[model samples]
Target chain A: MISIDKYAYNSRLRRRDPMQKLVFAMMTLSVCIWAEKIIISIAVIFIMGGMTVLKGGTPFPFFLRLLLVPMIFLLVGVFTIAVNICENQEMLLWAIPFAGKWIGFSDASLVKSLKLFLRALGAVSCLYFLSLNTPMVDLLAAFRRLGMPKVFVELMELVYRFIFSLMETADTIYNAQNCRLGYSSLCSSYRSLAIMASMLFIKSYKQSKALYTALEARGYEGEINVLEEAYESHWGWYIMAVAVNALLVLFVIALKSITGGLS
Target chain B: MNENILETKDLHYIYADGAVALKGISIGIKKGKCTAVLGANGAGKSTMFLNFNGIYRPSSGQVLFNGKPIDYSRKGLKELRRKIGMVFQDPDNQLFSASVFQDISFGVVNMKLPEKECRRRVDNAMEQIGITHLRDKPTHSLSFGQKKRVAIAGVLAMEPEVLVLDEPTAGLDPIGVSELMKMLRQIQTTLGITVVISTHDIDIVPLYCDYVFVMYHGMMVLEGTPKQVFTQKETIRDINLRLPRIGHLMEILKYKDDFDLDDSINTISEARIALKDWKARYLKR
Candidate 1:
């Protein structure tokens, strides 16, 4: 995982400005939400997946990881609707007597649940495609260029740095505990975790002071200086992204038209 | 007697928890000389170096740079700091920039140098430390030795007249230590910058320091040439530091011969030759 972040990969999608990817992600998500057609959502997912594969990298594991998160949400929605079938007021396609009431399942409810699940999956997939292709630093730089306040951007950078520093401290504490056989037994491991937490807090406080001193020595006068660059969105890539979004939009319009025509 | 680039007059500092770190310490750091502050842990060597760069304002007394007292004004301190570059003990703390190039250019950028000038200085400093290849690399990816070199490059880019280092070789392997020492010596000699080093390594004093100050119990106990201080075995031992290797070997030789010998040999080769010459003279007598 660390190596993936460290080494630069070749991808046209990766080279595009993060702001562009962010916009594309939002557009795809909104289209997925509005369009009730599963076919259109599936088409959008296929296009994003194709881009991942064509980037000449094995993104299958990352894709699986991304998919697993949304799968949980989909399962939750399915189970919630499945368990509360008793009070549902529609024509029953299936019914089972439970606790003195006819626990009924309807075709419309099932279809609604499945639609919500697919919409969520489509949205998550779009976000995964955007994040997996873009480096975080460049993304943050893009945010800075998007006219975000300097203080907020600097705070974000500092927070990112602090997370890594905390991780290092945690690693050191874990190693020290391991060396002392603190984790040899389950009881000892619990005790070690508590002690490590306290130690980590103290160490982090000291490190924060050291970091401040270091920053002051380097002439940090209350604000971090960030270089600004204009994100030139390529017309071709922008058009392609828009076209992908427009397909989903048109599908929604078609769905609305069909529903209206049926009514 | 020389112009004191940095002078601390009875500087005393106590931590917020009331632990006295520096007690009535006075020292004159001259320009264009490598002056080492030698002491053991808790002897207040680091406290003194912090004072040199205004990292710690003394609880009492004054810190003067170029005959002017350091004002509490932020602008004054920043200007003073620009003239006194500090290389911290941990390179990890010092080189925190995302990339090596940004880390090296940090002080330059802080000094508000022109973009082209900053780039030029960063390139020159990296070239000096032989780390130009690491320019675009993230700092977190570099090895400890490389990080130390980058930290030094960061400070060197500032082009300060006085360089203050606190245990620059601490936690370093022998090669890293040697590489750091070579770089420090080169910088001091070529640029004629005032180099103030605080270290626990006694052997480094004779080899690199033009003047040495021995600190004990939060005070500067002895100050003189390395030769003068190292010969005082009791004082060196009191500070929990060993005599330099050559001085230790000379002590052993003194028992065998009644001839006068200097206890200030700085290198192994010098000690070897001196031992051979002394033995030859003793045999003749």
Candidate 2:
């Protein structure tokens, strides 16, 4: 039932040399960071979102789900700041006056907190795009091409692979336990957890040895080469990407300048 | 006679926790023959298979590849391992690369082959396994059968002399098992690569293997052709194993006087034909 085409999209991104994507990401990120005005941040977010939707076939619902986490944090920050305003403030919105201003609110502080929340949201949105749209393999490959230390890239690859593998092993152990009726009570669940952990340790140890053997069998001599052929972006695609990003960067600068002038 | 490409000399292995996995096992794997190692759970079939590529160094014994003892030194082990590719029991363990193409190319890249040659081998391996269409697909999303095929392709890309598989057909549905057996048979015939597989599936051995090794308690208890091994009902019973269903049915037919049939029916289809012929003769009478 699995569609190969759906999975192929990730590799297609990988084909777009990691180095180019990294450069593109850095350029976009730097602009996002420097743009102080909310309008500019919102503009960059919308632009990036549109492009991701086009390239990744990602839906609005997917973006909504990703934003849900940061949205909660933003709400919490807003609520905390709104509830814990300092006393002796001019034009206080509300005051509990419990034990001398334990809880109060001020319009000025509220506006300032809202601005901070917006900035945080903007940063989070940019990160979500980068992490979700860009394949991790391509990112690591780009890092390697950028002259990052081999050991660092290797460590990253191993760590990423290990997380997925460990999860799979855990799932298998859980299934095996379920089949054996290993968990019927709270005590049994605790026992199952311990057993699962021990089994994972043993299995991981064995797999490490087996993996090394498999690697050696393939003529591995310390160097791990991925069979990724880097493709240069078409001039048209490069220009489009660069032009769009450059325009956003310039727009952010212009918006910031306007905000400064107005202030 | 073909030369012995791999041999184990009293190879012994114990787990870190002191469980003896293999105990003084000695066997020579002949080149270009499909050897099936059959054993029950905890019979050390896997431990013995792991020794082929020096995954586990024997406690006191030795493994020799091409008549040279496998040394634990990095260079020596790497050289020995490169010639004997293994597909683990779990396809998930073997197919860890992000995409099918990357998984297949992993061994080739490890070999440090030229990029063009590596691509050619990856293409060829995928084609051989009929998974060329899955090249760009993420391996995690594949079915168990598809993942197993990808695992085999990964090993095939390495072009090792011996392909050691641990329980290749385990956990597969009937159709998947047959399909995998068919693929393994094709690879053996077309590539002429030596294959050593460990499995509890006695049913598959008669159909695919040229020789069988039955292990029990960390030692090989029986070794022979499938015909020879399956005909020994007592030995199979001693090891807590059963004969193939066809063999069992053949024995039952011999016990019944009304069914006059040859005692040598070795496969289910042959048994079916024998039953049909008996029915026809009896109905005529």
Highest-scoring model, TM-score: 2
DockQ of candidate 2 is 0.45
Supply candidate 2's per-residue lDDT for A15. Answer: 60
Alpha-carbon DockQ of candidate 1 = 0.27
Tens digits of per-residue lDDT, candidate 2, A1-263, equal 12222332552354665465555556666666665556656766776666556665666676666667678878987777766645564557776666665467777667667666766666666665566555666677678777899989877876665666788889989999978887878888899989999999998888877676566656667776778754556566556668867887777667558767442
User: B109, model 1: CA deviation in Å?
Assistant: 3.3
Q: After superposition, how far is residue B183 of candidate 2 from its true place, in Å?
A: 0.6
With a 3 Å backbone cut-off (N, CA, C), the pairs that clash in candidate 1 are none
Candidates, DockQ:
0.27, 0.45
What is the TM-score (0 to 1) of candidate 2? 0.85
Candidate 2 residue pairs in backbone clash: A217-B81
Q: What range of 10 consecutive residues in model 1 chain A has the weakest lDDT sum?
A: A3-12
Off by over 4 Å in 2: A1-15, A78-111, A169-206, A220-223, A229-232, A235-238, A252-262, B1-3, B8-28, B57-76, B256-258, B276-285
State each candidate's clash count.
0, 1
Q: What is the lDDT of candidate 1?
A: 0.78
| Model 2, position A192: C-alpha lDDT score | 97
lDDT of 2 at B79: 64
